[model samples]
Target: MKEKQIKQFEEALAQKLYKLDTEKHARAIGEAAYIDEETFISPDFFLYARCLVVVQGKEFYEYVV
Candidate 1:
């Protein structure tokens, strides 16, 4: 794909990923991972958690995130 097309696709995919995220889903994984409340509050941790969710693939993401 062209660079512009790739950017558009990435933006769309990011939207889908964000739409899949919910407070309940975030809290569930944080609890499961034993992540401290303080650390969980960090924006970086949230982004990392989201990446982890997507990397697990569609079925797992649907099941957990």
Candidate 2:
């Protein structure tokens, strides 16, 4: 993705992560979510090599490294 788009995605992801209640989603893996320019480290899922797609009324693209 373009630099601007990537930045926007990162910002959105950060916001989501900040608001996320780790206790509700916490698993046996770890605590809190980690994100940089790329890659999202989840407690249960570990490392994801690609972006995460969520389909609601429309399509939401979450870019991960």
TM-score of each candidate structure, all chains considered together = 0.61, 0.34
Q: What is the RMSD, in Å, between candidate 1 and the native fold over all Cα?
A: 3.6
How well does model 2 score by local distance difference test?
0.41
Candidate 2 clashes between residue pairs 3 or more apart in a chain or in different chains = 39-65
Each prediction's Cα lDDT score? 0.68, 0.41
Q: Write the per-residue lDDT of candidate 2 for residues 1-65, one digit (tens) a residue.
A: 99999999889766655433343323323344444436455643532211122222123332211
* Model 2 error, position 57 (Å): 11
- Per-residue lDDT tens digits of candidate 1, residues 1-65? 89999999899769757965666555665444434466535556666787787778889777764
